[model samples]
Target chain A: MKKFEHEVIFCIVNAGFSDAVMDAAREFGARGGTVIRARGTANMEAEKLFGITVQPEKELVMILVKSAIKEDILHALYRAVGLNTPGQGIAFSMPVDQVVGLSEAPIEPKAEEQAE
Target chain B: MSEAITKKEKTPIRARAARAPRGSKRIEQVTAPHKLKLLFTIVNRQKAELYADLLQAYDVNMQMFLSAQGTASTEMLQYLGLGDDEKVVIASIIREDLAADALHMLEEKFRTIKNGKGIAYTVPMSGTIGVAVYQFLCNHRGDRV
Candidate 1:
């Protein structure tokens, strides 16, 4: 029942641009991400309202990172593929209360033992 | 005075609905009382189909699959016997009440099976446009919606 304070960042961009997202995230210390292929369901009216073209084929990049660096990674992603750019990707983060599959950290000697 | 105020309030709603186009009217009829949660599962690419079949038995269908790679270091991945970083991430929208059971089932599958070593989680959806759209995403094609 250990709790790992993490955030899952979702960056939805045009198809085939997930590599850009992963590269941007890695620069900011993000471990890795998963990309899911999705079709954008936004109608023509939504496109006009948002002032951006909505590509039907979309790539959703889901990155799991520590809460502390979530903002940095998100900002980095935005710069790489924000609405202003052709990618027109929108990024958001959600709280993840727990996680698994991560390798256990190597045990470190206690401070007293290290000083001995 | 109260009757008059009530009449005034009722007229605008009728007027608005009348003003709306045909599509808007269809949307109004399909609104639901509950919201949906999105469940995401990341696992080895080879195991994606297996998990999809497992989730189907729980009445959770309409899954979307995507290919991805893990960012873990090569050494760590080697330690875990994960040959390559290739992975498949699956997404599905389900009712809030079934989220707990779905997650539990995923966890149990991971524990009981050899290739179930992966991570699964859920994200709460604030709202959906209309019940029709929600039903479409939830893969519920019944007439009850």
Candidate 2:
């Protein structure tokens, strides 16, 4: 099996700011991303600790990108929607072992491909 | 109740082990420092429920999803839809072994189902908050921990 050196990056920001996260990520080499509706549970004390207003409504943008360009994308995301900014977004990445269903040549050939 | 105790006493060895005290309920799932993975499956909105239901058969206990506007290239989007390409992203935390099987099932479905092409991948989780949380997320339900 062909192993994919990919990173799944998640960016959580206040609602309506996912476009910024996706735009910043696209600045690097990210082809596309998925946005999930979420809500943050930051209270007044949390706001005091973080020194940023916490919007309860949150949007999580998940982008799958090659490991080679992970850093660039994250850095861009930070500048674009970091906590200091109104977006108050945080970004992190996780390692991905397998990728499927992309038009790119399937890692394990299907029976038809194998026959061919 | 006496009946409850009777049932407990009559429980099989494995079931008894499941209810065993001192945090030994998940003998198999928690045997090693096994970290679960988050399986992300993005598919067309129409088939989200079908895929989510299929995932449940694979011992996936916890799963959630929300509509996502895919950022596919314009040409690809046009091919997939007239203009709107609504997608659903399903996030499920599963044990590594089950995660692999779920990915394989998804691959097969994408190949066979019409208009069901999508992407699925796994991201290893670093830590879980509690043993019970871990058990529930990994589908080790009803076991005393």
Top candidate by DockQ: 2
DockQ of each: 0.27, 0.51
Cα lDDT tens digits for candidate 1, B25-73 = 6667976655577788888888999988887765575788878766553
lDDT of 2 by residue, B1-145 (tens): 9999888887786576767765554555565644688888999999999999999998788898878877654566578667556899888888888877788999999999998888999877778898878878877765554
Which pairs in model 2 have colliding backbones? none
Worst ten-residue run, lDDT, model 2 chain B?
B25-34
Estimate, for each residue in A1-116, the C-alpha lDDT of model 2 and write its tens digit.
Answer: 64559988999999999888987887786877888888789689978998966569998888988889999999999999998888999999888997887665423534586898
Residues A1-116, candidate 1: write the lDDT tens digits.
Answer: 64547889999999888878888888777766777778988888978998966679998888888889899999998899998877889999997754555445643554597999
User: If chain B of candidate 2 is superposed on the true chain B, what is its TM-score?
Assistant: 0.70
Q: Which candidate is the best by TM-score?
A: 2
N/CA/C clash count, model 2 = 0
Query: How much lDDT does candidate 1 score?
Result: 0.78
